[model samples]
Target: MSWVLGLSGLYHDSAAVLLHDGRVVAAASEERFSRVKHDAGLPVQATRWCLAHAGITMADVTHVTWYEKPLRKFERMLVSQVANFPRSASAFRRGTFNWLTEKLWVKAAIVKELGVAPARVLFSDHHQSHAASAFYASPYAEAAVLTVDGVGEWATTSLYRGGPGGLELLGEVLFPDSIGLVYSAFTAYLGFQVNDGEYKVMGMAAYGEPRFVDEVRKVLRPREDGAFDVDLSYVSYHWSADQSYTRRLEELLGPARFPGSGFDPTTAEGKRYADIAASVQRVTEDALVAIANVLHARTGLDTLCLAGGVALNSVANRALLTRGPFARLFVQPAAGDAGGAMGAALWTWHEVMGNPRTLDTPVLPGPGLGQAWDDATIGALLTDLRVKHEVLAPDTVAVRAAADIVEGRVLGWVQGRFEWGPRALGHRSILADPRRADMKDRINARIKYRELFRPFAPSVCAGAEGRYFDVPPGGEQLAEWMLLVAPVTTDDFPATTHADGTARLHVVHAAANPLYHALLTEVGRLTGHPVVLNTSFNLKGEPIVSSPVQALATFFRSGLDVLYLGAHRVEQTGSYDG
Candidate 1:
């Protein structure tokens, strides 16, 4: 009975994973438990929840694994900051203070915080953890692995071969030449936060043409060897902390977009920004495709397991698959730094313990791997909150929810367990009829209060994806987890389709989430389309609600017409009007 507690934190997207004898039982991000967006703390709340959910304590853990090699990471930072000299004084001060105060003692902190023996604590390389999280968790017995992120210790991008033997490094692209960093630099230049706002750039790209590709090529150009080069003169992310790009970038790409000013594509300035975003997105896709070509040539494998923050770019993922040589892709659902927690645990289980990998796990294992509450517990909480609600029979919960959707009501859904990844699958999602012309505006303006260009996703029944979306044949697993964008083939569901005629598709299967699949079935029976607009269940700038109390607060504060909480239903007329 080997129990491994894997952890990743202190940078961003901190998370915890509990693996029972190498089988992932529970995994969640600290942001979900702490109600903080991109929480970078120790993930104490998440760790405790994983242990409690697994019915174990730290004493039962056989090993505690950390995702990053701190000393090597610090060394990279120290050397780079020194090389940049007086220009990096501010970043150096902040980095040195953080390292000396807390990050330097992460191993000791993990031991003391979890009460694990000193010998039980182990550390894995950042990229290796990313690779392991994707390959080991994938259904593939063997595959080509590619991990690309802003920076991990020193490696920015790495290629590996995964088999029963173990993960073997084939080649790597070192720091400062990172595709992820180049994209993030453009993200900041376009008036968005680096890690948090990269997706916004992806969304904005769809609105404009790739008119600035030549200018973007100046920032990051692909070499004939399939490696890309980033010009440091145009970027400051290597040393500076506050700013990601230098003045040279602004001179080359025009003025940076102001952060708070509204984004309207009709305006010339907005159009310019959109063009820049489109150019960068195109360049990013080209870079990834080139790298994938190289990896495929080296490994000559048909299946690819992709991991890290860069893999979260669904649009690029689709382009990479269609343009590159790989026939299949199994992207880790939680591909950000948070997923490294799972990787660390699985790496120790397979590579360290010499256990054989299995094919029992499906590629699209559902996102219902987090905390959950039953009808009885939720009903009690609703009662305690003095909120008006009705508890429905188990069988009719989905039926009533489907009826509401058919009646053009925006519903809040809280069924089964919360999701493990960033995107809300069916579990904790805001549901609305995709066929409604005003659905996107109503949800984005009234409920989400987000940018209009930011598109909502579509959650389609597994078999119904091809009816509306042209999902590529080799990208089923990626589509299943909402990790890739596919063209929308139908005009019936306009809300989920983006300006570029594609949607970030999430495929729901009955075996993984029977309740969600049942709800979709009922929807299909009612409206003849099992698809619906699905987005995370929270307002902008906040983490998704984890508990019933948080869900209730969000329900009343937003323009949700009804709430489907567990087996209970609370409508707008039931003394709870937003």
Candidate 2:
């Protein structure tokens, strides 16, 4: 059997995936194994895990696919920096060092790291991989594909058509104008880290009004053609080397907020920032709608596939599904750079190796490709640690956890295999009653301990989704893997709905995961509501809690009421008496 290894590395969210005979055997991100938040390096630990999980050695890997062609990226960098002249000098130096030292030699580096010959290595364009990951892993036969992210060589945005026949790139928006960069620029201007903090901006946007929507429109204007340009005069990314935010952004939005400075959401400045965020979010949605319309008109395809960091915006995703022209949609669970690893492998299988695509309904079974521990294994660990625990029969664990949640008890639920991407799904989740308005604040203060304004997602039963959400599960568009957001029906589940009446909902089906489905069913029976507030089972500034020890630590450190690990249950006796 032939085997292929795909890699996306030397950047934030580095990852590796192994495909044996065109089937995905294993996939993981460097952050999970390295214990670093968004570690940007060769995924050595992750690669080793994937190989070991597949019961193979590096020698068995017949092909190695690099996520992006570096030489083309170098060309784009040279031209863009030259266009900016001396203003881009510092960025040019940093880019040159990074590329010359490591990125440009990605193929050789992969060979050296894997102890394989360089001849086995192949490469694909950055956006091609993104597009492949979206379409190949989706359950659609014929679909319009869109990939958007920060500069990918020269192309920031690309549209494609894919199906059993083949995949083809239809249109592209080149660099110097990117929605992702514009969002990142504002992310930095708001005193948050760039790649890591964009979501925070998304979360924070809910608190602000879109009053500045008109002002933002002055700089970011959409074109009649699906492609649009950012007014460079209102931005300065081309000139800066050390920072992501431009001076123009500060001038437009007022002085940058100090990174740690406290700003009450009720204040004028905070409202202004919120308005800007809402405005940007609106513009992004408009661009996506415009692009989707163009792709639909060109391809006449009813289904669409989305990838890239921007695709992670569940709000925008919901808009694309309901408001846009597409009748169906699919998004990769790990749509960020980490997903590039999966994209590279799939691209190799379908594009370079010339394998035909399939219209399989279950493109991805679930995002649970990382790790799993049975009750026996968990029992052994609990015994070794001398931790207090109760081992319930498999039939009763889900029911018990559901009852606890309905009773307003916070629970650390770790079941089955871990999820593949950033989201915890049902496997590694901290759950609570969504009907309780206080649940959000309590989670933010006790468990998440992050920004209070940030909202929590709801994990709901697939069957009951129609009652709670205004939008039906996309037929093939079900977010079995928590990739899409939809409007919550105000009459059904008001607590989970955001200020805009939207809920980032996960539609869980029984076939994909029986245990999680059973738990949600029990929760529905108890509370008369199928929804529960779900977040990753980890403390602030850490990867999703992986091990039993981590779950326990977070349970104790945070104010969680109980932890349901596999068939075992650990409940908090009382608050930390210290």
Candidate 3:
């Protein structure tokens, strides 16, 4: 059996995945263990965790693969900097220094970090990694693959055809013409962090009309063949690292929103910003739909696999499924740079190593591929911490937790393995009553401490999805990974429903997560609905908790009313009313 270790980081969302005999054993992001939000390091901690989880050492690994080619990325940076020359002097200086000092020698860095041989390390193209992550993990014999993201080497977007053999690159759109960057630029214009706040912009879009759609179109133009281009004069990302948009953008779209400023939807300026966000969201969805349609027409394949940062936009994903020609869609849960690790490993095993595809082994083993602690370990930790807690019977924990939710109490629920992706798929999640209108605000302000407009998602029983959500016929899988948004059938669950009456839904299957499924079933028995508000279990600007220690710390620090760690339960004792 061959073991492949894959790493993606140094840019953003650093992560590691261990593939044993072409099947994933463990995967996790560095940020989760490092306690940093989007840690951009070598992911040493994550690497160690993956190896330990697989009971293997670095020396036992057959190969180590990186998500992208550093030299190629440096070449792209040099070309961009040289083209802009004097205008990019400062940015170029920083980029060159970083690359020369660290980034360019990624293979050596990985070797040094892993203590592995130089020849053991390999590299894959950025978009190819994304494509491989999606297509290889999908349950398809053949499919059309689409990957879109902020500049990777030179390609920002790429299309591929994948089957039992391997993936073939079909076409690509180079940098400075990216839908991801365009959306991120708008995210910055709306006074939010560029890479971190795109989701916030998607949430804010639901509150307003697309009044500035024409203005945004001037910045991003879509063609009949599903290809698109950006007006570079308005974009400053190519030359300037500090600013994504130039003065020309401000002149066309009015003044940009101030970062960290308070936003009230009732105010005119706030409403204007929402309108701009709505315009960007609409244009982005349209462009993605156009691209999907073109890929479907070109490949003549009914199934589509999407990956990269742009694929994280659940709203745009739903639009593609409903409006595009593809009959089925599959999106890897961690469709961002973190997923590139898995892709690189798969690419090395099947494509570069000339190994045949194994149809029987599933590419992805659900999202719980991270660390897990058994009941004995959790109980020992609780005792060590001297925290007030109770051990309940296995069958009663879910019912008790569901009762807390029905009584309008916020809970931190941690069980089994940690999730391998961005979304908290029951393993590490905060649970709350979805029927309360103010539940969203309460959790946002007291627990998450995030923006007011940011929305919460819902996790419902699999078969009961259509009873509350307008999920399309083939959308069940997408919903299972929380990759699609659908309109709410009724306004009963206001907290989970966004302003547009849509919710990013997760359809939970009992076979995949029996405990979470039982909890939802109990919720249904009490409230006549099988859905609950679910979000990541961590404070703002922190990664999701991966251990019982981190879970307890967050529970006490935040306004969570209760915490369920395995079969043990801990309730807040003080008068900390939220």
Candidate 4:
């Protein structure tokens, strides 16, 4: 038996993945275990948990692989600092200090932390990890792979061909010219954190027109062949530490939004920010579409595997499917650096081990690939807390939870393994009825405490997705992972529908998450529509709840009416309404 441990960390979204032969035994981000949002430390807890879950330890693993070539990345950083010279003094000093102290000693760190042999530590290229994460796990045996992110070692964008043979490197767009960084620049300009706030920019785009596309084009121009020419003068990510944009970007886009300032779209200032966001999103979607077309032409493949942080743009995914050349799109669920860990493992298995791509590998393991607690564990915790709760029967839990939502009661739901990606899915999700018109505002104000423009998603069973959303052919794959945004054809479910009449619809599959699928069915039976509002079971800036203790604590603190921890239930009033 061959056990391969894959790790990606020390920058952001640190994670660990355990792959045995062709099976993904376990995968998890450190943030979940560490309870630190985007935790960048070594994935010590996550890696240990993975090994424990598989009844093994680091010593039992055949090899340990890192997601990126750290030395190559150091080379990029070193060259970039020298090229930028005095301008990069502070950023270089800080970066070099960290690299010298920690990042450069990755092999030593892995060996010390995991107690692994020195020679067993392997490293894979960053883009290759991103490519393997999507392709090897996709349903298509042969497909085109495209990975675009802010920067990975040196490549910001990469293209590849995947088949039973192996991945083929087609091309790359190096750093200092990245669509991902360009979008992140707008993210910072709009007064949000770079990597964490790009999704907010996507949501903010729906509120305004793409009126500033011309101005945005001046900063990032897309090529006919699906690449972009980014103006480095207008951006500061390459050199600056305090900000992603420079005075030149502010001059080009008008005054930047002040950080932490009140933003009301009814005001002209907020409207301007929205328009800029819309413009950036439009340009980004167009550039990705162009890239998809070029990759499609290059590979002549019907399916495309997309990964990287940029692929998490759900709205752009809808565009790529409807307007691009590919008939199908498969975006990695863990599309960010966290997924690079899983991809590195898969890359080692197939690309390095020379294993044939098997039908089993293409099944696309469900997102419930992390820590899980059984009913007994949850019950024991409730008892230990001296909390009044009911031990629900496994068969009746879904129906009772559906009834709670139907009665306008909000539920903090925790079940099975926490999701493998950033999305909450049905497990570790807060649920409310979408039919309630005020549900979105209520959750945003009282529960999530997030920006008003950030809309909640809807969860519907896979086959029933068409009834609520105008999902196109092959959209099921995207919908299963919350990777695509689709138009809500009707106003039947109002809360899940965003300003642009679209929802990042999550399609629950019976095989993948039977409890969630059943809950949706019961919801449809009670409300005549299966759709329900779903959001991650975390407040604005926290990682999703991983354990029953976290779930119970969050439920009591938040405005949630009830808590469902596995087959157990806890209600605030101590009275069962259903």
Candidate 5:
């Protein structure tokens, strides 16, 4: 049996994936184990966990694959620093220090970390990893693949054709002309963290009109050939990591929003920022649509597989589904750097190892591929902690949880394995009543402790998705992964719907997650709505809870009225805030 360990790190969202005999055995992000949001170091703990989960040691592994080529990336960094010269001195110094210390010696580091021979280690290009993660994981036999993200090695945006043998790089839009960086620069200008705050900007966009689209176009010039360029004069990220935008951007628009300042949409400045957010989001969707159209024209394929940081933009994804030429789409759940781990492993198994592709090899069981605790272990922990709880069967647990949700009680739902990606697809999620308008605010203030503007996603029964969402003709695949933003048809579930009447909806099929589907079915029977407001089961700035212990801790720390852990129903007797 061949065992391949895939790793992605030294940037953000480090992760590890284990492929046993060309099948994905386990995969997890470092943040889950490190408890750091977007941990950038090598995923030591995650690697060990994956090895343990696979019941193997590093010595048993036949090959180790890294997501990206470190030397190639370092070369690109050196060239960019030289191109920018004196202005990039500080960034150059920092880059040089990082590379000399760690990044340049990635192969050596992997060898040392895993205690494996140097010959066993392999490296894949950054875009290749992203493309592999999308196309190989997708159900499609042959499809067009697109990967767009901030600079990786040198390429920022890439197009690929995936078929029996492997993926072929069709074309690419190189660094300094990246849509991902352009969006990130605007994300920074909108008073949010660059990598972390892009979603917040997407959420905030719903509140205003795209009044700044013309100005945003000046920053990102889109061409008819599905390629785009960023106006370097307005962007400073290439020269300095400290800031994404320069003074020219402020002059083009208005004063940049100050970081950490609360968003007040009623105020003129707040309204202006919202408009800018809307404009950027619109421009991003336009560029994505253009790119998708080009890929479709070239490949003439019905299905498209998308990966990379830009692929996480559900709004743009939905726009592409409805308006672009592709009839169907599949986006890797962890479509960011974290997913590169899985991509590296698959690329090695199929492309490098000369293994033939199978029809069933690409499909995942579900997103809930992380660790899970059995009832006995959970019960023992609850007893040890003196937590008041009752054990119920799976069906009863679903029924009670549905009742609690319908009664407007927020619940911490932890069942089965935790989800592998950034989304909470039933397991490790906070569920609440979606019908109440005030529910969103309550969860934001009492549980999440996040910005009120950030919208929550809805977990709906797969068959019932069309009842509430204006799902496009070919949105089934996108909805299954919660990768599509669809318009809400009714105001019944106000909490889940965003200000723009759209929602990032997760369609839960019984075959994929029986317990979650049962709960949604019960919820439908109780309230005529098969949807529940769902968000990741974690507080602000923290990774999602992975273990029963973390789930219990978060349960007592937050304002959750009920805690569902496997077959146990935990109820806090008194008000105890951690």
Candidate 6:
């Protein structure tokens, strides 16, 4: 049996994935193990876990693949910094420091981490890794692929054609023009952290009008061939050390909003931020649509597979599904840097090893590939924490949790395994009754302690999805992963629906996750509605709670009413301020 280890790191969201034969066996992020949000180190713990999970030592792996090439990235950094000169000094210093320490010598580092010989280590281009992860894991046998993100070595966006065998690069949009960076610059200007808070900006956009759509269009000039260029004069990210948007950008937008600055969404300042967000989101849609159209025009492939961090934009994904050229879409659940692990492994499997690819059958592996704890582990944690808890029978955990949720109690549902991506899915999640209009406000203000505008996703059993939302025309293709947004027609579940009448839906199947599905089934039985408000099980500025200990701590600290850990149940007796 051939075992290949894939790793993506030395950048944000460092992660590792192990493939046995051709199937994904294990995958995890460094943040969960390191307790650092978006840890960008060598993913030592994650690598160790993958090895341990497969019951093999590092030396047992036939090959090790890194997510991206190092020298090429260093070249981009050096050239971009030198071209920008004095303005790039700050970013240069940061990049050089990182390169000197960790970013460079990736092959050496991987060997050291694995205790393997140097010859076993290999690397793929960042975009190639992203492309491989999407196409290899997707259900499509032959599909057009797209990967877009902030600069990776040099390329920022790439398109590919992939079949059962492997992928070929069709086109690419390189450095100095990137939608991801452009959006990130605005994310910074909107007084939010980059990389992490772009989703928040996506959510905030729904609140504002596209008043600045034309003004922002001056920056994102589209090309007839689906390539776009940014007005460099307005973007300082190419030059500025830390700041991404230049003074010219602030001038164009009128003024830069300070971080933590208060403004109502209905007010003028709020409206301005909203309008800018709307314009940028619209531009992003335009670019993605154009790219998809081009991919279709060239490949004539009805199926599309996408990865890279920008593919995490559900809004653009929806636009591609509805208005763009693709008939079917498959976005790897963990489409960001975390997914590079899968890509690196696949690149080695298909490209280097000369192994032919096979189409994944209808049964797509839902991303529940992280670590899981049994009842014994949960019991030990409860004993150590000295928390009050009861050990219910395995068959009754979901039913009990569903009853509590039906009673309007927010439940921290920690079961089976942790999800492999940014989304919680069924494994690591806080669940509430979607029918309660007050549920959204309560969770955001009390349990999540996040912004009021942040929207929560709805977890509907596949059978119940059609009752509430208009599934994409292709029907039940992309819903399983919660990668697409669909309009919810039913007003009964207002709490789960966003301002735009759309809900980021996770269509759960009983076969994929029995307990979570049973819980939703029970909830439907009680309330006559089969939807639950689902969000990542974590507080703001924290990675998704990984271990049972973290989940318990999060539960005690937040206003969550109860936590169901497999056969265990721990209810929060503390009063919530909200």
What's the TM-score of each model vs. the native? 0.98, 0.95, 0.98, 0.98, 0.98, 0.97
Better of 3 and 6 by TM-score: 3
Which window of ten consecutive residues has the lowest lDDT sum in model 2? 471-480
* Candidate 2 structure lDDT: 0.81
Evaluated against the true structure, the overall lDDT of model 1 is 0.90
- Candidates 2 and 3 compared by TM-score, better number: 3
lDDT of 3 by residue, 118-169 (tens): 9888999999999999998888889999999998999999999998769988
Write down the worst ten-residue block by lDDT for model 1: 357-366
lDDT of 5: 0.90
Candidate 1 residue-wise lDDT, 1-578, digit = tens: 98898899999999999998778888999998888899989888899999999899899998889998999999999999999999999999998999999899998898888787999899999999999999999988889999999999999999999988999999999988999999999998898888899999999999999999999999998899999899999999999989989999999978999876689999999999999999999999999999999999998899999999999999999998899899999888899899999999999998888778767764235688889998889988877777788889999988998889889999999987788888888889999999988999999999988888899999989899889999887999888788989999999988888998999999988987898888899999988999888999999899988888888889888999999989999876665422
Superior candidate under lDDT, 3 versus 5: 3
Clashes of each: 0, 1, 0, 0, 0, 1
In model 4, the worst 10-residue window by lDDT is 356-365
Task: Candidate 2: list runs displaced more than 4 Å.
Answer: 472-478, 491-495, 573-578
- Candidates' RMSD to native: 1.4, 2.3, 1.8, 1.8, 1.5, 2.2
Which portions of model 1 show Cα errors greater than 4 Å?
A: 361-365, 573-578
Q: Please, what are the lDDT tens digits per residue for candidate 2 over residues 115-202?
A: 7788888888899989988988887778899999987878999999987866788989988789898888778778788888888778
What is the TM-score of candidate 5?
A: 0.98
Q: Where in model 4 is the C-alpha error above 4 Å?
A: 361-363, 574-578
* Count: clashes, candidate 6: 1
Give Cα-based local distance difference scores for all models: 0.90, 0.81, 0.91, 0.90, 0.90, 0.86
Error of 1 at 408 (Å): 0.9
